[model samples]
Target chain A: MQDSTATNARDAGRAAQRAAEARPVRIAIDAMGGDHGPEVVIPGAAMALQRHPQMRFVIYGDAAQVEPLLDGHPALKAASAFTHTDVSIKMDEKPSQALRLGRYKSSMWRAIQAVRDDEADACLSAGNTGALMAMSMFCLKTMPQVERPAIAAIWPTVRGESIVLDVGASIGADASHYVNLAVLGAAMARIVFDMERPGVGLLNVGREEIKGIEAVKEAGRTLREANLPNLDYRGFVEGDDIGKGTVDVVVTEGFTGNIALKTAEGTAKQIGEYLRSAMGRTWRAKLGYLLARPAFDALRAKMDPSRANGGVFLGLEGVVIKSHGGADVKGVAAAIDIAYDMAHYQLMRTIRDMLDETPIATAS
Target chain B: MQDSTATNARDAGRAAQRAAEARPVRIAIDAMGGDHGPEVVIPGAAMALQRHPQMRFVIYGDAAQVEPLLDGHPALKAASAFTHTDVSIKMDEKPSQALRLGRYKSSMWRAIQAVRDDEADACLSAGNTGALMAMSMFCLKTMPQVERPAIAAIWPTVRGESIVLDVGASIGADASHYVNLAVLGAAMARIVFDMERPGVGLLNVGREEIKGIEAVKEAGRTLREANLPNLDYRGFVEGDDIGKGTVDVVVTEGFTGNIALKTAEGTAKQIGEYLRSAMGRTWRAKLGYLLARPAFDALRAKMDPSRANGGVFLGLEGVVIKSHGGADVKGVAAAIDIAYDMAHYQLMRTIRDMLDETPIATAS
Candidate 1:
């Protein structure tokens, strides 16, 4: 018994040493962000650390508020584990104005700054989306040849998953901006979906070239002219195609993208509510529900928004991810994982390199 | 007993006559327009007629195809109950070009022409939406003082229901178009929801007046200046508000509105699939599904596109309802009913009077 105990201790120590030598990837999280703030953010960071011990986190917020949430987590206190930056960004303020006014002390601003200063590899926030985009653009700046930055969100589709660009970053953009969005989205799909050459589709009212407004027609022409290498430009796609996943990347202006994202969310919730009500109405249905419980749980797990928490603001100088404001701890953890994945993929460097080689012409 | 039976028959016939006299409104249906042609459209029209025997229908399509579908339906074939016009519109042609090229022979064009000739009160179609909008615009022209036409769709919500305007009519409209949509939508809500003063919200990326593209912001200002008496101008609303029923009427340009509507449909389908899968994975969930089946069915029935088949194109001089191309018999029935309602409310006349009172000032 004594010999076995000694062997176990030694093995544990060796495992610890190997983990320490792995050099944990640093992620900067806006702790004072989101509706729930540090209460949700800190625990999520701790949870992520528990799952990925090789990931180090820089929590940017009021240390006083965040430290209390880490009270009993010993692993979070390790030398190579956690760090905190005292700052935060308000959820209600105008994004551009907030970034300009609270440059130094705001948690969103500080998180982006950490990535720029090389203190952290990537930044994640669940704060004001506008403010985060503004800060990311001002601090890290856009990629060398990119016209404007775009936010890309993963839409849960029936076939699998698809990426929608410019969910709520730059509004009223021209055709050039849409072309940039397609390129950036393609880069994201390559990293996220492991596709060498991603299929790109321009979101329009209809599949026909003459169907949509002038902007969509112009964007289609620009995308064709750009002749992006790793992007297979599929002509045009309607709203239903977003879920069909026929195209890997769907590009549109921020206004349309934001509306599409929110509408999808609202419709999902409505349908779920409808199903619940339908199943509750009859005894025979109740029996069917019992027989189908496991499948239902599996479906719920697959569709859970918490599993798909992070949205990346692409075409910027650094890796910046935005989580939903209403996200819980599980969602925050998922966002952290996304930030890690982005860092592992070296997203910023890849975008910068791609932009350097291709000089995208701005629409006059 | 013989005398009583004769008296009862006479009383029933008298009651039917009273109902018919009370139902003064008539709706024109383009029966040969949809994918299913008269097979589905005739049955749907019959269903509507059965529900409201007083309602008269003017069927326009291929008489050979429509007549067989109504063979055994005595009431549908009654001379006082039905009128038929033989013509057809192909689905693939461009709406404007189709209207200009085929107006003399097309069933859809003739249906709208009938409304103009005062033979029918309103026109409904399950054919191409673009063609319907174009034909209505050309045949009816814009309301005396309106600048552009818009489309409005009633979307079901958790709380109740909300109206979204400019679904796909006026693709590249200016600020004035959005304001017109708001005014038109508010008028619709007053009739549909029976609200004396409907709350109108301008759809934007954010709730702030300063947010959104230049067109939206400019429209917001125009809406404010209009000071519509029966409109409670709610400043701004996001996409989530569509299903939340936060406001009675939501106004946006055609581009954003079309995307939002399609996204909602896609997401509802996705959520339904997710729930089905989840229910199949576990015994407990399967049982729960059985218990909840009736409630789920009810919810689905409410959210089903088939139940809400038709959308009204507003700001035109006459009523033009567009039904989903994939609509089945049941969907066709609902669309016919919607057409009846529009005519009953004198929706076109109401819009014309409103516009005439407040003549739209066209910007040079």
Candidate 2:
């Protein structure tokens, strides 16, 4: 009976080891990125480790600052491999200037470089978006057939969530750039939503074919003609359609996309302000708010911007996730969660496969 | 004592008559416009007349349909002179097609023509925006020194309201067009908000000078260099700034402005849905909601889109207020209120004066 029990235990141990070996989703982090830097990033990483036990991290920052923060979370400390770097990119620094000054030496660059070197499956940063993009484009380069990279955000909608691409990657995009965005966004949507053929939409002022800018019209025409295999081209979607979750992927040039994203955020904030002021106006209202606090908590959870923190840098050869510069620990953790998921799902391979399947005539 | 009272009464009557003559803000209405047409328009006009007793309307529509509706509102019927037109612009007709078919004979055309011919101070229509803009442009012609007419909306912000221009008037704008928008938007702001020099901001992806498209950057440069007397050019503003009321006038190309407006609407709707679902989840929440119903009602009133219904057609030879096509009676009334306000304040005169004051070198 003892021998049989030992054999069963051995078998269980072997299975656990194999699972651990197979699920190593390594993420490189720029520890000195956001406003709080190591204070938020270290705690965020620790929290992420709790959720994803199999995930590993290569954290880049000044050793003196980051090591002390890591000491607070022993489990994360055990799972992480620390890389020391004294240099850090400034939040206000221009992209071109940052690239010149902090290329190979900065924490931001090294984190991205780790992904390029295949030491880390993905890179996560809450740094200057322009600088990060510049470094990412310079280091990782664009994927085959991609002219420019885009930032794809998981936008919360009435019907769960949708992917919105080019949320401030670059300002202007041509017809083909929009098509590329549609393709890249669809690829991300598939992995994130676990859908084989995600519905892709071009974000425009109106849904009519002749209503938008010439570039958008041309992109729509191209998307309709190609009828890409990996994605379902759903044609034009208006601004309101985004919140309605009318499509799985909303594609647009960065200028409009960025404006739309910020506008939504601002609107959400404005409504929140209204709600607070309304509930505090009278004693009866205050009492009601107190009684319905739990419900409000749930509503708050649904509206929490931190839950939708990460923006994946699409069309790049290596995976990179950008978190908001002002993100708290929870926001940073959410970003890490996205990085882990992307790496675990082999996002690059999926993107490559999808791109290969896309007909070259339509993509260009 | 009886003789003195009689004299006072006679003096009061003459003063009232003079005030009526001075405050004649004639508004021409396309009664066949909007989803419900005369059903909403007649009642809306009656409501506006209740608020502004001196206001008169030249209502244009199929007399058979509109006359009965007008009969229901005795006060509006008394104040308004009905104009019969069997032709009306369809909601779905393309701009060019609507112009071709509806010009000269359509209700929409007659209402705008009234403004151009000096029979009415302003024109109000809730019909197709594209069609209305096309007809207004063709009939009224662009004002001197104006390149393209732009639609300006009164956007509700946490801090009162802000004026956002080019809300789907036209798609693309050059640097000069943006400057035109800023100038035109500021002129409207002066009349609407009663400000001497409204703070104007150019909308962009970032507040930084280097961030946006070239046209926007160029506009910023021109505004700064000119430092026009009628507007306080406050560099650049972002999407979030619009809701925060960072500037009195938010200027952008029509495409982005329209999207921002719709996105805000969608976000507001989304939040309302979330609030409803949250309140319905538990008995406790329901009870709390019941108690706080008044507070929620007040919040609803504050967030009501109807209050901010009018989009003033700026850069036109005459004032034209465009209401949302799907607007209810209350929304239509709000639009009429804007038309009355604009006409009473002599909006076109303000625009002409502001344009004359602008440095020709910078304006061009």
Candidate 3:
């Protein structure tokens, strides 16, 4: 069974790799999604185009606002088809409210619709996370066998990077949801990390601390029992394992995952503040900081949150990426880069096939 | 109503302060706890004894193993009464199994029982967290109105330290449980941080996202409406807000709180690794590192995990502290220091009073 599953995955990977090499990935951009809107998105698309010349864009936004910015980037403009929409979702709008106020006519909805219509291979949004997720679910819908969609983040670790999923796409999860998260996250890790069988771990507390939530333990049993070929289930990992790169994919429910993600970001910022305050304490410290400018710059670059900007919406029928609302041009480009890879590799079909192959009964 | 609550708290604080100043705090030492056992615990107790001369100790452990170690610390030996207990809980023992095997005879359980029997003011242990919590709950039990006890950690933040509670004492929490956590955490914060009304915040996702769990929303309403005098309830705070010191006490369920705490620790460690690697990259960086030794030392001191080593078990009828099992002498001393402060301030009575004063009906 394992050998046959391996062979199946290899064939699928090879087929995806070959097709990706032959075609350009069409990305639908919600130009007026984030804080800076077209001012950042247009230039970000231009930057992404430079990295992957085989990328094309289908831009949707208010024409007057986005057209001027698009014209500023000649290369991106030349490879893009522009669509005009007068409405754009507000950053602070609630998910349900956003759906009511701007569902059909909004730039965010239209961008996701393009992907469903087969006009774009993938969709990218830098709007409100809740709004973007709601619209994506409404427009693209969940794939077969997927209970609900999840958001996956590329976490930077000492060993490189790992994929963490269910970072606040929803509130609660059951046993099957955990299994779904593990499978979906593994599929993303396989594509992102470029591995045949990405190791997956269920996020849990210390082993000595009375086993974690019951759903986590149940999911662990199911994953271990099934022993799917495309992914290796490495039992349980604690919160620290995410930064240690102990596994390629860390699966968790949305509530804890979101809190963990935000807490890490907060800690990094706190340390940065401490570092700056320490460095400015004395004249000698200031001189040392100046001399060690390169080291500081390197550290800054490594800890830059924008480098890991994109949050891929998993278990969907079409590829969707949600960039941070406050992300700058570089960060937006990072999101687009993920969209390009995911769309190019046909992640939706990959997830569908993997889901169909998984034994859901084992989870029960 | 607010003014009256504040005045009542102030009077209670003054009475507790006078009583604390008039007497010595006796701490029960589980000498068999932690990795180094009596070798580290004796020295740690000695160190804490130096700073707090009025502290007395009731040490429990295997006399054959602990007698020689105690003799090495003359002052601690003189101030402590030693008891021989051969049974000790293993680091990996399940909570239930630990109870069955080591409940009555073990050093960990006996230390907790001392507080309950009024033989000691407080208890301290560096044994298995789950075992300690189980023993603590079983021996000390919950105070009136507290559904279950919570483990509160003194979290280091940019502004200062914040008290975060329910960091894995138990898995799930209801609205009333959250209220208990908030009240208990605020009582500790008032003693540790020396504040009349320490600002409290409910740990939640971003205000913009869909509202958090139903229990969280319900708790928010309860805390807001009750308007307790001992704590200033500042609506909602996200995970990042913990590090920003946005609130004096950050309240959440054990599952998410534990994950957030561990995730922050992992992030801090990861950045430290990144910094070290960057500093070693070039000769200039090395030279600069040497020149800025003081700055690095300061940052290291700021980030030292040992400085915040104790987890105070709140909502209990008596004070109990769980130190890290892998902690060294300094870390153990830190935990003892917290135990001393909590005992001195009469935390149990403070919590009891607050619980009695709080309108529990509002929580539902």
Candidate 4:
């Protein structure tokens, strides 16, 4: 009986080790990229480690700026997997110009380099988006069948969540870029949500086939013609459909996507203020708020900015996540988790495999 | 004493008639437009009459569809200014195609004709925006000084409110269109906010000079060169600034503006849901809600959709206010009030004067 128990324990230990090795993932974080910089990023990193002990992190930025914030956290300090880069990409700097001028010194560039060099599995930043995209493209290069790298963010919706691509990656996009966005967004939905066949919708002024600008019309034709497998072409979707989660992925040019993102953020803030005031109006309303408080709390948690912090820069040779510059500790932690997930899933490898099987057409 | 009283009453009556004659303003409404068609429009028209008895209205669309809704409203029926066109524009129809096919038969066309023939001072529609814009331009024609008419909407901001132009007017806009939007948006701010010098911000990705697309760059240069009087060309503004309301007017292409507008609406809905959930989380939170009810109610009123329903389509030959398709009675009332105010202020005449004085220089 003793011999049988010992054999079972040994088998369980071996299985655990194998599982850990199979899912080995490391995330490189830009520790000095956000508005609050090291203060927010360090605590976020520590919290992420507590939540996901198996996940490894490389802290990139000024060591002097980051170390003091770490205090005596042994996992952050003594972990052989962690390291630092001594530079940062400023939020106000012109992305292209900064990339050209500060290529060697910028933390953003180094982080991408780490991912490219296989020093880290994925790179994450809360820095200038343009700088990050430019650096990532320059360092890691685009994936095998991709044209432009798109910044994709997953937005929570009524039905579920949908990924919006080219959020601010390529501005003034042509038909081909949008097609690539659709492809990348589909790939992301597959990995993120385990959605085998994701619905792709072209963002437009109206849902009708004939509505929208010339670019949208041309893009729609290209998307339909591509006939990508595991990509259900759902046609056009308007602004309202985004929150309604009518489609799994929404594709558009960076310019439109950026404006859409900002507008959503602004509107959310306004609505939150309004609702708080509404709940405070009368005794009966106040009582109703008490009765419905649990449901409301659950809904608020779903919509919290911290819960949706990280956005992936897709179509690159390596995985890269960008967090909002104004992210708090919780937001940073969320971004780290997203990066860990992308790395563990081997998102880039999956993208490469998919592209390898698919033939590349000339600009769609 | 009786004779003296009679003389005074007669004098007052004549004074009132003279006041009315001095400010004769007429407005044309597409009575057959919107989901409920004449049902909402007729009541809105009656409400307008109650608010602004001095003005005149020309109701365009099938008389049968509109007249039934106005039954028993003697004041509305007695208004000889009301004229009907026996046609309608369908919401689902393609704007460009419909405009061409139903050029003479559509109510939108007839409303534009009223403005062209000087039968109405301005025209309003809660119908298909593209159809309205196409018909308006076709019949009334672009004002000689204006390049392309843009649509402008008032978006609520933290500081107050800001005007966003080219909501969906010119889809494939160049630098010149953006410059025109800036001028139109600035002019709107001056009239609407009674500002002698309104600040205009070119909506872009970042505040830096080289951050935006080529069109935005060129528009920024053009705006700087024009140096219009009472215009504070404040260069570029990021997305967050839209809600901050640091600038009185924000100019962008219709594609970007539409996305921004829709995003704001979606975000607001999301935030409202979040806040409601948060308030319902705990017993203490519910108790606090009761105490803070009045203040919350005030905020809700300020952010209510009814108060922010209408957005004026600027640069057209006449006034046209677009209401939300999902607008309720209160929203419709708000839109009518906006139309009434525009007519009373002679907004179109002010725009015409401004355009007449400005040179037709290419916007960089």
Model 4 quality (TM-score): 0.88
RMSD of 1: 10.9
lDDT of 4 by residue, A56-172 (tens): 766777877777776657786554244566557788777677687668666778777778766777888888777777788888877545668888898988667889977887887
Candidate 3 lDDT at A3 equals 43
Candidate 4, residue A279: CA error in Å?
6.0
lDDT of 4 by residue, B175-233 (tens): 87777788788778878788877999988877778777898999888778877776789
* Candidate of highest lDDT: 2
Report the C-alpha lDDT of model 2 over B1-364, residue by residue, as the tens digit: 1234334433443453344357688999999889889889889989989999989899999989999999899989999899899799999999999998999989999999998887888999999999999999999988656788999999989999999988888788899899889989999999989999999999998988998899999989999999888999999999999999999999999999999899899999999999999999999999999989999999999999999998999988788999998999999999999999888876776776677667744322
Model 1 stretches astray by more than 4 angstroms: A1-23, A79-87, A225-227, A280-291, A356-364, B1-23, B79-87, B281-291, B356-364
What are the per-model DockQ values?
Answer: 0.43, 0.65, 0.79, 0.30
Comparing 2 with 3 on DockQ, the higher-scoring candidate is 3
* lDDT score at residue B302, model 4, on the 0-100 scale: 75
Q: How are the candidates ranked when ordered by lDDT, highest leading?
A: 2, 3, 1, 4
> Tens-digit lDDT track for model 3 on A142-254?
76467889999999999999999899987888998999999899989878988989999998886532388998888888898999989899988888889999999999999
Q: Per-residue lDDT for A117-229 in model 2, tens only?
A: 87888999999999999999999987656888899999999999999989998688888888888888888888999999999999888888988899899989988998888
Residue A223 error, candidate 4, Å: 2.0
Better of 1 and 3 by TM-score: 3
Local distance difference test values of all predictions, in order: 0.76, 0.88, 0.87, 0.74
- Candidate 2's C-alpha runs over 4 A off are A1-23, A362-364, B1-23, B362-364
